[model samples]
Target: MKENENKNEIVEIDDVDREIINLFNEDGRMSYRKIAKLLNVSIGTVHNRMEKLTKNGVIQKFTPVIDHSKLGYNLTTIIGVRVKGGVLENWEDRTAYHKNVLCMYDVTGEFDAILVARFKDTSELDQFIKSLLREPDVQRTYTQTVLNIVKEDLSSSKML
Candidate 1:
């Protein structure tokens, strides 16, 4: 059983559930029939398990793994930001909806939050950093450009 942090619910996942998840992680478009065949189970079992997994919040949503560079988002950056006292959440809420922000975290260190964002070019990145600086609560920001991506997999199913 795994605990869902968001819902505070215990999700019971058996070996079959793990296998189904692994197959979907490899290919999200895989059909229930195919998964059933591969796992040597009935198609109904696959459907029921998927439904239970989704209902339990074990499977959030199926999405494609995109290569941002192929889509002209040529620059990837990791930025650490320091916010004014008591306004970290406010700043996070304001910034979370930005199209360029891929992921954000409330972290422990010198910085209050960290953001991973992608930009089309340096000009866009410059504009974004300047915009953050313009915010009253944003005390400072440190940006680092990524030169190469060794590996990027945003799937937890691999760990299972």
Candidate 2:
């Protein structure tokens, strides 16, 4: 059900679809009826468009953006890592349970994997680091503290 060509396919999007996407990108929880009212379209049209959009994979899942610092997680870092001994296997399964993990990427540069994580303080970060080191295949790890987040969001991201 997934196609590699669909990964970055450029398609002509109607203004209505673009508006719907833009509005939802701004606020995912906005009601369809409210959107319909705003767009001056029928509720059924909104529903049908949304269904088609999602089924065709034009829209992914909607989720809330959280402020981890307000939740007592102030420390954020990008930990460049090297994995050996076929360690990338089942890596997602191993790390999915970690609450502090923000995102992970397999890359081809100086690092085999890049882990973006957050913690409440130095202790928590140290503990997570120690845990990563325990993986025998993990040869080395370098962490850089995130001093600031200028802009991060779907609005800033490139869309198809």
Candidate 3:
């Protein structure tokens, strides 16, 4: 791993680090001993690499991939938000922690920000949209209901 003067340092990884990440992606709870055996390295090496990866922000967190649909959140929507000038960051800060928001992005398009969110049903979605409109900085919104999700993988290990 390489260090930088700034907090957001860009860390470099080698083949061993890639393998360790790939194994963890396969099973977040996999034992370090198992990873060491698979990679033909000592358990200490795996532990050290993982510690470095986490410290460098490569591994943000170990979490399960949930099936929201199974939990009654079957409705998914992509919303394009148009915010009043100079308040997009404020709006994002407020909305980012909302329970329904899966991910948010600032993109190059007609809209200021895009939000991907899930809801239990249309009523919940309606209320959520109305709440957004009630915000002072929100000018308008265009929402698209997702009929099908062909691919949704939130794993960074695949990029390795």
* Candidate 3 lDDT: 0.93
lDDT digits (tens) for residues 46-154 of candidate 2: 8998887886778767778888889999998999888774767566568746888888888888778888899999999999999989977778899999998886673
Candidate 3 versus truth, CA RMSD in Å, comes to 2.5
Q: In what order do the candidates fall by TM-score, top score first?
A: 1, 3, 2
Once model 1 is optimally superposed onto the true structure by TM-score, how far is the C-alpha of residue 96 displaced, in angstroms? 0.8
For candidate 3, lDDT tens digit of each residue in 108-156?
7799999999999999999999999999999999999999999899785
RMSD of 1: 2.7
The sequence of per-residue lDDT tens digits that candidate 1 reaches over residues 1-160 is 4454558666778899999999999899999999999999999999999999997888989888988889999999999999999989988999998999999999999999999999999999999999999999999999999999888887857766
Task: Give per-candidate clash totals.
Answer: 0, 0, 0
Q: Which parts of model 2 have CA positions greater than 4 angstroms off?
A: 1-12, 154-160
Tell me each candidate's TM-score.
Answer: 0.93, 0.86, 0.93
Each prediction's whole-model lDDT (CA): 0.93, 0.82, 0.93
lDDT of 1 at 118: 99
List where candidate 1 sits over 4 angstroms from the true fold.
Answer: 1-6
